[model samples]
Each structure stands twice: as C-alpha cells, then as structure tokens.
Target: MYSKGWIMMELTMNWITLRVRNLEASLDFYHRILGLPVERRFESRGKQIVMLGIEGQPKLELIEGSDPPVKPECGVSVGFEVASLDKAMAELAKEGIPVARGPIAPNPSLRFFYILDPDGFEVQLAEHM
Candidate 1:
C-alpha cells in the first residue's frame, strides 16, 4: 500500500539528443553557427558523436547519420534563451540568418523571437520581460 509520506516525483530535464546527417558538419554548425560550446565528444562503430550544452544547462547529444539533408519547416523547432532578444537576433543576422519574429511576448512573463535554424527548426531566443 502507498503511504502518505511518499513524495511525488519531480520533473527535470537532464539532456536531449539530436540526430544529424553528418556528425562533424552538424557539430560545426551547432558550435560555429549556433555558438553552442562543445562539452563532450565520442565515437561508435566508426561514426562520430558529440554532446553540447548551453551555459549551465543540460547537455544535447548530436548523433551523425548518412542521409540526405533535412529541410527546415515551421513548428518543428526548439527553443533557446538568450540574455537579450535584440542582441541575439542581431548576431544571428551576421550569419545570414534572419529572425522570423521580433521580441514579442508569447505569453505573460516572457519576450521571445523565432529564428529558423538550418534544418527548418524554429529556435526561440527568449528573455524574461
């Protein structure tokens, strides 16, 4: 029987894995284009894999594949937070990437913009309002 003293499980995000067509190219894009720092790297079966993470956030695993390039599409994107919305968007512009949206409030307590990643993923660069 369950006891009243039993504590509920807490929700936490430890890490995420992203499948890519090319490990080295994807790693370069993520690190050089997206500017995520590489925290860990590894290999398996002659294939390369790398893990990256943001400042103090959980790691993101990048796995290499041998497939055609994946195209980007709307609604298939991830989100990342930045210190300043305007600054982040401006910086992305230098990479020939444009912000699809501005620092508009998606909901209360937040300001964000949607930036299209290379794979058609919508990356949200957000900040607290």
Candidate 2:
C-alpha cells in the first residue's frame, strides 16, 4: 500500500486559563451568574483548578494563585455571545454586577456590553441580530 504524504489535523481552542485570587467567588460568578456549567474540578501541584463550560465547548479554567501584577484592563477583553443583550444586562444588574460600558451597537446587526468580573477582568457580552 502507498503511504500517505501528509495528514490534516483539526485544531481548536481547548480552554482559557485565568489566575484568580478567590477561586470560590470566581466559580460562583462564572458558574452561577454567567450560567457556565462546571465541567470538572481538581487540584494539581497544590493549586485548585475549576473548569467551567458546557460539553463540546471551550472551557474556562480558573486557577487559584497569587494574582500577577498586570492590571485586568491592560489586555484584550474576553467576549461572550449571549442570546439577548437586554436579558443578560438584566441578569447582571440583578446580581449587582455593574456594567463598565455598553449595550452599544457596533452595527445594525450586533449589540454588546462590558462588565467587570470579581477580579476586575473586563468581559464583553454580545448579541447579534
């Protein structure tokens, strides 16, 4: 049989890891408030890690550790797509999470808002027409 010259591999993002000061609070915010399911929780190298996301989707890993010196606002914002921006905003308000900026329409077909997580990380929730 002739040997294949090359094989194509599909690549996709697995997760995004965030170093958190309060693991429990972060877990509550992401899992309870944002409605991301807990995929798993485990300890590694004496550090606690919580993975949150629905099955078949990219997971968000929250690791308990000393916070780095970098300010949360100094980097790119993490974006999440929501079914309805208004409903998401209402939920955020109900949870006492103030909107940093937002509900702005980038174009006719899209709306978005920004809110800070428990650690001051900016997260954008967007809705598309």
Top model number, TM-score: 2
By lDDT, the best candidate is 2
lDDT for each candidate structure: 0.72, 0.87
Clashing pairs in 1: 72-119, 72-120, 73-120, 77-122
Reference-based TM-score, model 2? 0.88
Q: Per-residue alpha-carbon lDDT of model 1 for 44-112, expressed as tens digits?
A: 887678888875788777777665444564235667777877787777888787778776886888998
Write down the lDDT that model 2 would get. Answer: 0.87
**Cα lDDT over the full model 1:** 0.72
1-129: candidate 2 lDDT, tens digit per residue: 765444424566899888888999999999999999999999998889999998999999999976562468678567899999999999889989989997799799999999988888888999999
